[model samples]
Target: MKNSRSKPFVIGISGGSGSGKSTIINEIVERLGPEKIAVLHHDAYYRHRPELSFEERTIINFDHPDSLETKLLMKHLVQLISGEKVEVPIYDFPQHLRNSKTKKISPCQILIVDGILVLNDSQLCELMD
Candidate 1:
């Protein structure tokens, strides 16, 4: 038996680089059906540094929590929980910048937020149930 409420059950998946976080997410989605879950990757919220050259951006330490726009991610999560549509930002890894387009995410029954720093943010932690 599972909870069938309107509000989603947010699952925070955190781990080190190359630690199989996406593998775990894939398994969850496979079992739960992708339609029932909305996946939000913290890496997608990486701070945009268009002013920097490709070489400079490539040299930046992406491991630091400061490298991500976590505040915006938190806001999107809050909005989703409130049953509102949110335009999730897309990061262009190769370009090292946020893409001009956003993924429009609708409210869902399960919101799975995955990233190395997902659980590190106090506000984000409070919002997950």
Candidate 2:
């Protein structure tokens, strides 16, 4: 069913690496029904460094907020909230690079932004409900 509200109810989930963030998200999605929710993972927004070699990318601290394109994520969130669809980037963990293809995500009743740094950024926090 389509969301009747003008904006989705945004929820931000954050935790350390290896934490149960994804687990929690999965459970929530299951209970709430995936068809009524949209999930955006911060890890999927890691900055694409095509110029850097695989070795160099590996050395970079993936945990650091600078390693992600938070600005783009924020923009996408805005678009989603505005009842627009977004093309989410696909990141390859093994190669430490963004995949050529993107996943199209539609706005839904609930928007779950999952990542360790989701709550770290003040601007991002402001966007959450």
lDDT of 1 by residue, 19-100 (tens): 9999999998899888888988999999999899999999889989899999999999989999899999999998899999
Local accuracy by lDDT, each model: 0.91, 0.95
User: Per-residue lDDT of 1-129 in model 2, one digit per residue for the tens?
Assistant: 455777899999999988999899999998889888999999999999989998899999988999999999999999999989999999999999999999999998999999989999999999998
Q: Which one is best on lDDT?
A: 2
**RMSD to truth, every model:** 1.2, 1.7
TM-score of 1: 0.94
Tell me the spans in candidate 1 whose CA falls farther than 4 Å from its real position.
none
The local lDDT score (0 to 100) that residue 63 gets in candidate 2 is 86
